[model samples]
Target: MADVEYEPGSEAASNILKDLQEKLQTDTELQERAQELILNIQDIRASVNAAKAGAGTHRRGGDEVQLIAVSKLKPASDILALHAAADGGQVHFGENYIQELWKKHAILPTTISWHFIGGLQTSSISKLARIRNLYAVHSIDSAKKAVTLNRLRPDGFPVVNVFVQVNTSGEDSKSGVEPEVDGGELWDVISTIRKECPKLNLVGLMTIGAIARSQAAKEGEENEDFVALVKVAEGLEGRIEREEGVKVELKLSMGMSDDFESAIGIGAGFVRVGSSIFGARPKKADASIL
Candidate 1:
């Protein structure tokens, strides 16, 4: 093909138009992705609404579901877009690894609140405590972890919000306090933290429901877990409130990308969503990435 020469102004205009077209296409794709997210969010919201309506029939407080988008393993760009869409609403973002979270927080604005959603080792507690906007630590299942967090909390912060993770399914490999109706040893641990660890606030309870093959199966199973967590929270609420002298709010941090709706229906104040919000994550090379 012969090279066709054009006037300088004409060539500039043509290049500008091509750039604009590409930008428009990129915007369209982004909008489409955002719309899909909004639909999924609406479905979750609807489930919470139905649960709230049903709660009125009973004498309990209506379901007040708080969606905590699990942003672990996703790119910072994706988190920024999701937060922009949220429009300043207080949305909780959950992270698994301390290093990954530190990187994300460094890049992301401090206004976005975060929850540490993974297992906490004694060593990492000091670093986790330093993050100013860390709203809650969801996997504080044992006294050891609680003590570590209490010791590491920065000065001037009244208390670090935390949840006692209860393993309702009794799986040995699961990461939570084994559910005890009497609150058993865990109760004593909570009391110790309350009394000794002046900087830590035992806010509520959390758990990971038994995994199921499909979304429907997951939802059915998680609903029971969610309800059980609520009962546990209600049971502990009286004692914790009386002792702490602060209204101990029961926050249920359950649900993944799969069964969030059911979790909300049973009153999950915070649902941790991962893949559904950020899309499938890239595979990690090793355990270090986690």
Candidate 2:
């Protein structure tokens, strides 16, 4: 050790040097991670813009296309980050699982509206009905489900907005009503709700886009499917309006990360997005993640 006289500022200089060393170590990785997140955000914005542009010249009514960010199985932090970036309180989020949705709702601000985007069982009706800011329910495909929801809805709230899900592709495993069903049966179910269900408001119809492997194939196929669903909705719109004694504003809740542009172009008022905004989901331990 040099036992010579040390300079007066040596201790102060050493302390500053130590602080800088620690800060450099801590901030470099943090800055890199932040930069990566920014780049990802840019990519998401580009995709969204492309979708909006591809949607093309559809006369936007007073209502714009509402983007419901599907946050199923995603961490709450990711949702927070998205909310921070959004403007005009425009972000509406959707969740598939009841428990996860509840958890996220607990952590997220009340200002953000939540949509139940999954097939809701009767047992979960009470929990869903109690959520004060639930913007809409997108999977009310059956009269029974509608009845259950009507029964459980809390007093003093406006009727919960609901979309009748139609299975346009006629897939056996899918969870929506077939759009090409008997007219009597369809009208019976829909009319029953209009007459009887006081707490549920029939706002629109939702259908899944035809799932295809390639982007071009998916777009072409889904455009056909979307056009079909739109025709079905258009066919029923006047009927529902006549029965309800008011012009029913019908929303077509179709499209996802892949085919939303086509859906939008064909008049999708609501588009559900998940992986496109949150990035690729982490693979499940046993199941393949989509």
Candidate 3:
């Protein structure tokens, strides 16, 4: 993709964003894009709808499924093009790096609802909390991180949505709280969120399940990782209601580009799609979070 040339200034964000979106929406022949870079908003939306219609496990109805465009290694221009392709309505985007996330947030329209879907750590907690338009955080794996994030959230701001990441696949490389919740680490953190973290809204459970699980779902088998996430959500909801005296309906965030169709079909509240919507992204060797 060619570098997006636009005037720089605080006032120029919406203007530039709108201008780029208009041009891209109209497919104005300004620059040729790689075959992999083509934005396919229509196809992605249609596929999501189709999957929803065929959903056999959607618990809360198909209309509740939401798509979070996982634009991790993609550029701002591609985001603009996709936004334009959706007639400026598809605004939710997922990012991995705190640094890249903020930089893009600074340049893009604040109307965009950003979801941080990468590993959350102590070093980047404050910066992530400071994002003005952050819609949700899908990688909160620890209680301390959750507490600190809640404390760092700007005063008077609406509680930012939070999803407790669970390592359902039990993969050593994955980052999430363990699936156990019977007075274990997962239970402790969830309790902390409901009782101590007032600035954070515990909205759902998220997981980066094994690729094998994704493939298995496509083959008409159960994605145990997703099933585990749903179980956790149900367990937490019951516990929270009984102990904390708060009625809560936790959502599920377990689908990705590879298995989103099956995930939505299983009634996931949010599906993070990347390559299918914005095309394949080159690998990030040393992605910065600061």
Please give each candidate's TM-score: 0.76, 0.76, 0.85
TM-score of 2: 0.76
Judging by TM-score, tell me the better candidate of 2 and 3: 3
> What shift in Å separates residue 103 of candidate 1 from its native position after superposition?
0.6
Clashing pairs in 2: none
Misplaced by over 4 Å in model 2 are: 1-63, 86-90, 181-185, 213-222, 241-245, 283-290
Model 3 C-alpha lDDT per residue in residues 166-237, reported as the tens digit of each score: 999988999988888677789888888878999998888899878786775646776888878878787888
The candidate maximizing lDDT is 3
Alpha carbon lDDT at 179, candidate 3: 89
Please provide, for model 1 over 36-149, each residue's C-alpha lDDT reduced to its tens digit, 9 standing for 90 to 100. 665655565566567566545442334466677777776654555566565443357889888777656554556778889898888888878877778889888778888888
**TM-score-based ranking:** 3, 2, 1
Question: Global CA lDDT of candidate 2, please?
Answer: 0.68
RMSD, one per candidate, in order = 10.2, 12.5, 4.3
Q: Tens digits of per-residue lDDT for model 2 on 204-265? A: 88888666622545424546667777887877777766666677667789888887766776
Could you tell me how far off, in angstroms, the CA of residue 102 lies in candidate 1 after the best superposition?
0.8
Worst 10-residue stretch by lDDT in candidate 3? 1-10
